[model samples]
Target chain A: MEDDYYSIDSILSENQKIQCTFKVDIPDMGHLDGGHERDIKAQSKIQLPLWLAFILIYSDYVDFAVPTPFSSRVRNALNAEAKSVRLSALVGAGGHWYGFGKIIMRLLDDAQANEMSDLLTKTFRDRLAEVIDQAQHFAALGPAGGGGQSGDSALAFREGLEVTERELFSLAQESAKKTKQWYESTDRLRR
Target chain B: MALPVSLRNSITPPELELVASEELVEIIPLISIERTAFISGAYGPLRPPNKAKLPLWIAMNLKMKKKCHIVPPDWLSVDFLQNRLAQETSRPEFSEFPFRFAEIAKLLLDVASDDIQNSDKVRSLLKDIREARQAKSRDGLQKIDHSELGLPNLCSMEINEIRPFFVRAMGVLTHLTRDPEASSRRLDV
Candidate 1:
């Protein structure tokens, strides 16, 4: 099952164990505090192997969802490497690593930013089902059955379903609005 | 007489209407349709299970049932059953569970051999369990544990840096779902 889902073999086949060097442009951290600026400047050039890059990307998702002490170690390792390299050197060594990492990271960031949109889509799907289900349930009760007053009861049930449906629809719409907001924000970030 | 005429006109008897009884029966179909739709609709996207690895699949279902409280005492037994099967198949055995599949299978085979009359029933039950297990293996494969599966340490990255990678992974998932060809292939499986 894991093999089917991950296509680990395919990933391995595509894996390129190429040595890559890249210069990271470290913006002048004059605005930052003394130690922080120095730290940022020193760790400007980023160099990592392809395998490490994959691990880093995979770890990002895992860490985002569940923060653990182990995640901190990985984060520190990446940061420590980044901090150690000079910014000018990072910019100088442009290789597959830098290009590939940038593209993948950017795509990932876009998806993460649009999480609310995904949530909205899910909510919309759920609400649509809920509304239709409630409507049918009420209709099922019918106009007559319960103690000869089933007509009244059915009518009441229908009204209740209608109210609930309306509420769900409204909630879905709100979700949609939030999704739109997220989409716009993500679009800006991507740009 | 003129004064009493106004009061008499105001007083009227209530009317009762008899509704058709057949209309009541319509409720059953309505409820059925509603229930079906409700269930179908509840599943956001349906992915079919793979047919291969029938034994392992059964083990997973047994595991799921154990988790969901559908089968209580059987959870441990199911875990043992899975280990035994894994060992029998020479598959990569799960590290966590204590009992191996071979042991459980041997025990079951021995019990069935002892009770010749119930052997068929045992075989039949075993088959059913295997089918159930296979049903969920595909989904289980797709399921990713965000914490444990990936790189060792990720928590220390800044939120700004982390957000992008997370989005990318989700984008990949979304793309996988949206691809009609891939989805159809999965469904066919």
Candidate 2:
């Protein structure tokens, strides 16, 4: 998913860090962990950007932990009520939860990858209705509403949207606006 | 890879209106005019007091110039719209309607209200019909699946309204479900 050379989101998602441990000793790279040591020992863990981790993990030089965003607790909460889960909170700022999930699933083996992918798809399917509803709601309110029309719950839901969902929200919003503008801009016939 | 933003994905409502304008409409010309040709094809010989068939744009132009009285389409009347509004509200599925009804309705009601009987009532009924249909479409969107959604009677405007959402949501679904093992196998092969 991060493979698109021209996509900004793809590049940004590739830069997200994941936890991994070196499988074999590597020389003179200890400062990567923000330490003054001269070498990285085998089995020591540190966060690595996904782009580099992709190579090392696939080549059997590093092993990654399941990132917290896709951990069972978050998965359970999503399963319980997907629309209320603050997906952004699970992943933190500047990280796209869906985007990172795809890369992580790729890094895992067949069974685990399948489980995570299924979770991802189901979560999106459940929450998509809410996202579209909010987009259309905001579009109807127009910018002049300053987004206060839907009140606190909607604002909270909006703030919790990950970057991918945010993009989808705006696309839906712009489309709604275009339809409304077309409706109102017609020339009235003079009597 | 490179395309203008305005022309991407789905058609805009204004563009839909342009398409709707090509639909032929009935008009009673108030003055005589010779048969004329335009790029979209020929129309005219519009004579006084007798009805003529012209493209909606031509009818609108003549109407705006006080050269004709645009005849509102049958569906633009209060009774017809009331019936549709009843169907729209009573049924879960979208009521069958003209593919470009919203665009055409706007064109007629905006400029030719005088020619339409019970114009205000007609306007309100159109609004009721639109609102009823919009709610149904929103409900349909909520029920959307990754594989497909059966929304058979959706009009051009309704479809356009939901296009961005449907496209983006499907994009996410694809991203989530794309096979990773096969891809990695191919990549590291």
Candidate 3:
């Protein structure tokens, strides 16, 4: 729940430092006619290394940090939807608009894109429900009151934590692998 | 690290040694520019430049030094530097360069301390070096050969030890072109 693993602060600081250092303006080299003479001048001001930039940009969807204005706009839109849905007369209409717009729209439109969106929504919802169920079950089994049953409950909680950690690691590994493959495929296009 | 005795004692090939010495001397200022740019928050990105640009920048700087040409006036434009710094800091990468961000940072600090302590001497030296280089180009004469300048031979242990640093500096230049923002950020850091 804390999201401590992401270290967003460190990443942000690092980003700021990078911004201060490298001058990224590329001069229009097309007009320079001389061979190496022109090439050297053009070469001097390049900011990022091509291979690294290529890798970072093409790496993964989740890795993409939304540019500032877009993020703020999206947040405002989501907030507006939540307000409108809460005020609606129809039962569950607010939830539908605030939470399940893509799903309800797909169910109504019955188009291919909608269907895909529905499928994804359903999958995510099911997975989230499963996680909540597991957590609730553990929480219901209150702290040990000094008995064999209590000891068993503690063991169960420990096991659950281990399982969850493992799942998180597996997810991270899978994401990294997918990103690597995506980068490799896109790198070919740049060449 | 102290140079190996064999390298220290070995006589350098006159031509190649001369070239190497000249390269070493010319490289100092380029390194200075990079360091200054970095400390002044001019280096764009925090990340290292890509491999291609690294070598190219080094080669270009070397050529410029050899030709006694000034870096284009626009090279250090503020807007360009700021943009590049933004990019580099936003992304981090693994590189083959021997020194990482921490090492480079330390080196820069050491250089800055030494430079500030000898500000006038360094400034005068820089002015003379630039003037001499410019004069050579204007007079249509070959510049002072490395040996004539009393530089240590290219094959000398001291020079060899400094080679990697030069390569790293060159790599920074290359990164500047590829991810200016990242490079700029790294410099700022």
Kindly indicate the candidate among 1 and 2 with the higher TM-score: 2
Which wins on TM-score, candidate 2 or candidate 3? 2
Candidate 3 lDDT over B1-189, as tens digits, reads: 498532342222232223332221112223222322422133321122221112223333433444222222121233433443444334332111111221221222222323233334433433343233222222221122112222221223223322322222223222212222443463354
For all candidates, state DockQ relative to the true structure.
Answer: 0.01, 0.60, 0.01
- Candidate-wise lDDT, in order: 0.29, 0.83, 0.28
Cα lDDT over the full model 3 = 0.28
- TM-score: model 3 vs. ground truth: 0.14
Model 2 local distance difference test score: 0.83
TM-score against truth, every candidate:
0.19, 0.90, 0.14
Model 2 chain A, TM-score vs. native: 0.91
Give the winner by lDDT: 2
Deviation (Å) of B109 in candidate 2: 0.5
TM-score of chain A of 1: 0.20
Rank ordering of all candidates by DockQ, starting from the highest:
2, 1, 3
Per-model C-alpha RMSD:
28.2, 2.5, 30.6
Which regions of candidate 3 fall more than 4 Å away from where they truly are? A1-120, A123-191, B1-78, B81-189
**Candidate 2: what's its TM-score on chain B?**
0.88
How many clashes does each candidate structure show, in the order listed?
Answer: 34, 2, 62
What interface Cα RMSD is found for model 2?
2.4
Displacement of residue B139 (Cα, Å) in model 2 is: 2.2
